[model samples]
Target: MSSYAAVLRTPHACRAFAVGLLGRLSYGVVPLALVLAVKEGSGSYAVAGSVMALFGVSGVLLSPVRAGLVDRYGPRRALVPMAGGYAALLVVIAGVCLRGGASGVELCVLAGAAGTCTPPLGPTMRALWSELLPDRRMLETAYSLDGVCEELLFVGGPLLVGALVQYAHPATAIALGAALVLAGTVGMTGSPAVRGMGGGEQAERDGARGAWGAPWRPALVAAGVGVGLGGVDLLVIAFADGQGRPSVVPWLLAALSVGSTVGGLVNGAVRWGGSARGRLAPLAAGLAGALALAGFVPDPYLMAVALALAGLFVAPALTTAYLYADELATPGTRTRAGAWVNTAVNAGSSGSSAAVGLVLGQLPLALCFVLAGVPALGSALAVRASRGARAGVPRPESVTRVDPREPRSTAGR
Candidate 1:
């Protein structure tokens, strides 16, 4: 607990983290709100789902580009306009939905446009954390804390929407989400830490190209993790429905969240002796193994237990990936590098969910679980192979290995 306190105690750390969380909460709120609003306006689930798909696809695919802008222009300049445009689009979307006259095409166009302009708050806040905490251990704690809070916000956002929808139209929630983001972004960018940060366009372009290739390990692992976890929700519901216990689905999902939360906190508190890269593959493997065994559980209760066990590896794997991404990133490319991993995870999740839905009807349930585990296992193998590929190569005499634990200067970054 004190370790986490040490992280918050850093000057300006609390404010930046708080405002970032506030802005990011909209990410949780908007998706469900948009779906409901579009469904209400269009009178069709099909149209709503299609609109969301377009929105998510645009956001996930363009994340790195937006992050590059943040890197090239600095956060203060890049994020403010992005948030403003995004908020304005959300307002337009809410107005269209509430007025009840807009066509499906118009709603889809607005949602996609809003998604394209969606602020890269998560990636940006992570970059800010790196800048604020130069010490590697504390940074690890910060990432864990951030991950857990994010997971909770996602859980809470839906409940908040659930409450709001009882008394007000879903479009109202969309408008509220827009307001939260605009307010949070304005407050966040005004902070001294963000103000002090510089644009890295020139430095990023001048740096060696070789530095760009190294972050693939973390990004790949993150994608694999995303793929493994993405289908769990549907799979768990399927398992429960098969047993005629549909009511248990929510409890099972909550178990996964609880396990992940506990695992993330524990991961940060421990002082592990290895590079984040070295630990990442094993963490992924643990998740893959646990998920593979999930299908063998005999009942919904057992399935919940199995998933909770699997969940233990979830946050730690991702936290390690983010930490590794930071380690691999140059100061100028920090946001872009993290954004790649962010994009990979989201893309993997979206892809896997659709793919899993297609195959679930055709395959045996156990086989489906095994199939879902393959991506993470493949990622673990790729990491090992990459390491072996480099093992035989001789190190340059000019370069010396830096101790992973050493607290170095953050002069340029």
Candidate 2:
């Protein structure tokens, strides 16, 4: 608690953390909101899934490009327009769906457009964190807290989306999420804390764009994590449907988030001496195993428990993956480096959605769970080839200097 407090003591830190959370809330809520809206409009989960699938693919293609812009031009110059543009897209999407004006082709195009426009706030916000706080322990704590905050968002986001979709409309939830993104980005980029920060140096920016200069390992591992997430999330929803209690879906997801939140808190608070890379694979394997086992559990309540167990290492694994990205990437590409992980996640989302959708239509749910875990395990293995586990967290570059003056202690920036 003290460490957490210490991290948030400065106005800079507090604002960065808050803004990150606000921006990411959209990420947490968007999938369900979009899915339900599309489903209600088209009367087919397949169409909904297809729209989201296309969105994921577009996101994957756009993450690196947008992140590169952030690295080169700075987050404020790069993201503010992005945030607003994405919000506008969401509104358009909602309107189209509500009016039933879009054909399959149009929906696919809109989904792609939305994905391409979607702000990569998660990575950019973390880059801001790296800028605001350069201390090692505090950085760890900040990262963990970020992860924990995301867990908390996931816990609430689904329920919020579900209720809105049921009561008002899916468009309402998505529009609200869009508002959060716009507000968060404007607030974050406009803040003094973020204003002081620069993008990467020219050389680092140049290298980020160069072929063979990418952070391939972290991207690969992140992709695996995405695959795991896509599979596990859909399976859980399936499990609830299978049990004839779709309303319990949020509760089950909340359990998983609780476990992940606990793990993230512990990982940050307890500073044991080990490379961040060392924990990546085993933790991922554990999460994968837990995911697979959960599918076999007959009861929905038991399945929730199983998911909780599986999610225990999730935040830790993800925290380490980012740390590894930091370690592996070139000096100037903070946002771009981490953005690859986001790309991988989007890729996994697209791939897994397609695969899981197929499994849901053709095969048993149990098989879907088993297949989902395999990609993560494979991605973990890929991490090994990239000096993973054996590598330590990256040291800050000597050239990247912090501001001379310190921030005032305050909850509000």
Per-residue lDDT for 302-342 in model 1, tens only? 88889899889999999999888887777766787788888
Give residue 369's error in model 1 in angstroms: 0.9
User: What C-alpha lDDT do the candidate models reach, one value each?
Assistant: 0.84, 0.75
- Model 2: per-residue Cα lDDT at residue 169: 76
lDDT of 2 by residue, 18-106 (tens): 87688888988888898878887777777887898888778777787888777767778889888888899888888877886356767
Worst 10 residues of 2 by lDDT: 404-413
Highest TM-score, which number? 1
C-alpha RMSD (angstroms) for model 1: 4.5
